[model samples]
Target: MNLTLHVNSEQETLDLAALLATLLEPKDVLLLEGNLGAGKTTFTKGIAKGLGIETVIKSPTYTLIREYTKGKLPLYHMDVYRLEDVGGDDLGFDEYIYGNGVSVIEWATFIQDELPDSYLTIKLEPTGEFFEGRNITFEPTGEHYEQLVEKFQKQASEEGLI
Candidate 1:
């Protein structure tokens, strides 16, 4: 089942992402879909924190990809937004996606053909009631992600965060 979470502030969004980060494992892929300024990078920073990464998390918009290996598990952060025009054929992103790390792809729609058969897609949207309020949905494409979402839901419920 898919999991939907509500957050009223930037911190809440970060905290929620951090909670989900705890359940991540190597080779896990998370596709982030949202409009500009939708907090994708903020959520990613929280994941880095949960993974024990000390380095500052920045958007890979210009760099295309950023590798953070100081964490318990490496994080391969990719922003495919720029690839919308050129395409992602020769980027060799498969190495990161299938590597011994968690890969988070922003603007994933730009590289849909490069994605694996299974992964989790996170969609964020403004709630309109509050400036910082957001509606986050976790859509799982396979068994692994399904279980991940299930565990996250249970944990968030127990912590009274969702």
Candidate 2:
């Protein structure tokens, strides 16, 4: 299923991500797609906060992956943007994608084939009409993910976070 939301600011994007983070479970995989300034990392910071993590969340661009275990569930943040340049699957992606932690992958399309059969995807794009406006699209692949999306949307609507 698919759901879309218009985020008016960076905080709104983070709020949305936090709300979705609350509904996530161990082993959950979120594929994030967007441009350089599309707020992917900002959204991830919110997820880290919602998961009860206290450390600063940053892009794993150079490091490939960052692990935050202080939260209720471990969060494995990954950046596969460099995958094309360094062509290989030796990074052991499956360990984290199917591991006992929540995996949020940035630029996931680079390694889409390595992802699990079921996962959630978030696509963010800037809306040129308004300043700080972002068009966020969600695509859930399985019943579990679909239900998670439904719950997030419901909570977001009730809290006026959408």
Candidate 3:
């Protein structure tokens, strides 16, 4: 099933992402797709906060990947934009994707073929209503992800974050 949400501001987006993060378990993968300033990193920061991470979360645009292990479950944040220009698959990304942590990949389509059998894909699009407005679509690809999304929807609704 698919769930669509309207993000009114950065805080609302972060709140939704944090709520989703709470439902994630180890080995959970989040595929983030959006434009250059579409708030992918901000969402990841929210996930990090939900995971109980205290460290600063930065974009891995140039570094490709950043690992934050202080959280309940480690967070592996990856920006695969460079992969498109470099064009190679020798990074051994499976290690992080299947690791004992939650993996969030920005520009995931860059390595779509390398992804595992199941993962949650979040597409953020500009609504053009407000400077921070966005129409976020959550597409769950497996049983585990389906449950996760359901729980997120419930919590978000209860908390008025949806």
TM-score of each: 0.97, 0.94, 0.95
User: Per-residue lDDT of 67-100 in model 1, one digit per residue for the tens?
Assistant: 9999889999999999998889988999999999
Query: What local distance difference test score does each model get?
Result: 0.93, 0.89, 0.90
Pitting candidate 2 against candidate 3, the one with the higher TM-score is 3
Runs in model 2 lying further than 4 Å from the true structure: 86-88, 129-131
Q: Give the winner by lDDT.
A: 1
lDDT of candidate 1 at residue 79, scale 0 to 100: 96
Q: Which regions of candidate 1 deviate over 4 angstroms?
A: none
TM-score of 3: 0.95
Residue 56, model 3: Cα distance from true site in angstroms: 1.1
Report per-prediction Cα RMSD to one decimal.
Answer: 1.0, 1.4, 1.3
Estimate the TM-score for candidate 1.
0.97
How do these models rank on TM-score, best leading? 1, 3, 2
* Lowest lDDT 10-residue stretch of candidate 1: 125-134
